[model samples]
Target: MVTGALAAAGFAAGALLPPRPAFASEQLTIISWGGGYQDVQLRKSFFEPFTKATGIKITEDQWNGEVSKVRAMVQTNTVNWDVLDVGVGIGELCSHGLVETLNWNRLGLDRTKFLGDDKTLDCGVPHHASSTVIAYDRTKLKNGPKTIADFFDLQKFPGKRAMQKGPTSNLEWALVADGVLIKDVYKVLATPAGVDRAFKKLDTIKKDVIWWTAGTQPAQLLGNGQVVMSTAWSGSINNAVKESGLPLEIMWDAQMLSLDFWVIPKGARHLDEAYKFLAFGGSPKPQADMTRYGNNGPANKDAMALVDPTIGPNLTTSPAHMANSLEFDYSFWGDKRDELNQRFTAWVVQQ
Candidate 1:
């Protein structure tokens, strides 16, 4: 009955292509950022059930969040992926016709229920939301810092700190800590003086910060007592704590919340099945089930009531934690990604 309902919601099976196509009629291919976060979560919470319900064999693969590969596969007439897990570039790719456009009406997806408005999403189906927040070891700092300013203030909360090497969230956090309002972070970051101010604020703790490029590093550092607090991915910290019982707590103040969406590459092998997978993956129950094992906040607003309350408070989209967070500006990153990436890299090496 549920599968029948999803079919009505646009999950109708596609016409079986030739016997020797890129994927057989029974096989569906999916690409995502593998490892525990994407691999384990999707396999258990999404793929296994999807396969059970539809009897389609699913083959999962991983990528390093490189849209270039997706573009190449599509342009070369060798597109194999049915669905893609993407962070940024959804809009640009959609405009360039590199990814398929979404039909909310057909998918039975409620636009009003997703976290951000439709304009912010660029036609991708968001599975869950995660944020880069301050994660502290409660055992070490009983009275941990509450705001971005506290995270920056060396004297008030003195301890080793870890920050992602990139400047996306760091730049915004720096300005907010230096007295810029959370709402004005991007506005100030737009100005030359504001850029200087953010860099200078970062310089204050340059010596104190342990730069990390991988998502797992911050959680590991916190558990190993290498840093008292770290700017960590909310999901990664939650998983670490659940697996090992780490005394970690996340501070959601000024958090830069980001949504990971499922997109279909242009001319994907299985368009109907891809759409079906995305819609199924984001429905209330599946979204809620993901939170039971990991800290990812469900994209469906109606799904919150289904999540265990014990785990709800730790999710990035949880009401208690989400009120103080900011939706990351996807447009800003789309426009300035390269320029800022270069500047940030140079600044990091020079420091």
Candidate 2:
């Protein structure tokens, strides 16, 4: 997910949640990117089970990873959202004091058992790791695309291509498709010439590209033949293939792996209850349970062993998938996103 502030014009669009007491409350509100990702993976495993055990009814809300909404809530002291599922901009959120600095002892989970690096775990608990992989419907393309380069080769695999409307994985993938080795993607991307090269490659497909913002659109686009192939979230592709019986297949090469985190907005009313829910959801058991419903890998290290073997190969953490994967450089993006976002938008407007 692209992490940053979004305009909070629709902040009051959802159910108006009643504020909870810090010590005890019957209700605790948590927000995540809603859809099958939340409905199946989170609702079944975390929300429902946590409520059953603790009797804290969860008021679930959905957003598209809008850090600005959280920022607005914190600034106004109307923090109804207790726990947030954030991506990419966590360090900025922590530095700006938009979210609380988590007390690890309060959760009592083993810090070392978490899967992400130290920088990621500093302010928020790791929720799950998902990847942006090249996906296509096998039934449409009998001889399917096999690599990132194929996704760009209009002469060989000609059709409308779908990708999210941003410069996240798209920029990195453009470089890889243009022949930049995965190991040096960030190193090269840091240079001006490399950025121009990535844009130059994207220019080839700009006319053929179909931009999608919602997570659900990619699989739908592929399944319904709106496009021959797309850059889609692995969990969405997994759900379409497993549950909906879509003939979607994923190309894990050059996959951009990203982590989602559980954060508490600074003024969150239900601090105590929030910590309790975080601890329960962050444990090996609940973390592992997420895999039963989607392709995301468990963020708890011990939970990896507990993932059902049947679905293990489909997960981002699977050794086969990780062999050629590129970890999304949060630090680099945190520094460069705004500049690139502007550049990408300006480029998109050209004929």
Candidate 3:
């Protein structure tokens, strides 16, 4: 009876119901980062099951300039996206009134079952967790710098090193290198002098370091031996290790941990269905399945135990890795992003 009622509601709302509630809605679309094997996992785990269960269709598009797209949609009053996966910095922008605040309870997901009793909230739910780790080619550097400080100490660990070019993570890394405690990251970065101090510290390594604009670029550089040391995404570095036989090691100490969220725009056509899909995607089983294929740990804390042990340890959000690292404060970064970006841009261009 519930299934029939849902099917009727879906038909009346012009929303295609997934054959089952466990499946995704028909004709749903997702916006995500382009490339990487994560999309493949999404297809096999989420999209396929969603289609099969609900008899709903799914499509995905790369979210290259999604902010602009969202803004345009807002201007035209015609939102096209049902779900979006945005970075922490981007999430800050959305939180300022761009995207809708999700109501987990209304969506029928037991928040406690997913994110735990304390962490689950109505605003946004984390989708994947990752870290910025130091990956070094073992053959090239016999004793590569093991910590972020050593990564910045070019004199001792002399070789081509690469760091992310953008303002997002670099400023925090720079502050970390400058002896600011990880817990005090944003507090230090909040001041003009502290911001300058970070840029000044980064200036020392600017000339010798290669600036990587894309995530895959760092992995490619590490694989080709173009750089002996670099800050790389955990999954990308792992891929390099497996595919290219690069004797790369990740230093977990002082790793910058981050979480990405699945968000909905304010005026999406399929809010009800989108919320249902979010809950389904956030479930433990599907999250574990996602990790197996893409090496990304799902956002659900409960899902951690379900992941295969072999891949689980390497995941950024895994218990072992999470213990050694600091969670990137999304609220802090979201708040101070523009100031940091402006300062970072000036520093990068000066290089």
Per-model TM-score, in order, reads: 0.87, 0.84, 0.85
> For residues 21-59, what per-residue lDDT tens digits would candidate 3 score against the true structure?
333244577887766543676677776786665555556
Show model 2 residue runs off by greater than 4 Å.
1-27, 55-57, 89-91, 224-226
Question: Whose TM-score is higher: candidate 2's or candidate 3's?
Answer: 3
Across 1-351, the per-residue lDDT of candidate 2 in tens digits comes to 121111121222212323421222445889987877788889998998887676566888988776687788888889889998888877567667788887898899888987666766767898788999999988889898888999999999998999999999999999999999998999999999999999999999999999999988999899789999999998778877878999999989888988888988898898988999889978988888988877789878789898898888878988898889898876678778889999999998888
lDDT of each: 0.81, 0.84, 0.72
Ranking under lDDT, best-scoring first? 2, 1, 3
Model 1 worst lDDT window (10 residues): 14-23
When sorted by TM-score, best at the front, the candidate numbers are 1, 3, 2
- Candidate 1 lDDT score at position 77: 86
Candidate 1: where is the Cα deviation over 4 Å?
1-26, 89-92
Best by lDDT: 2
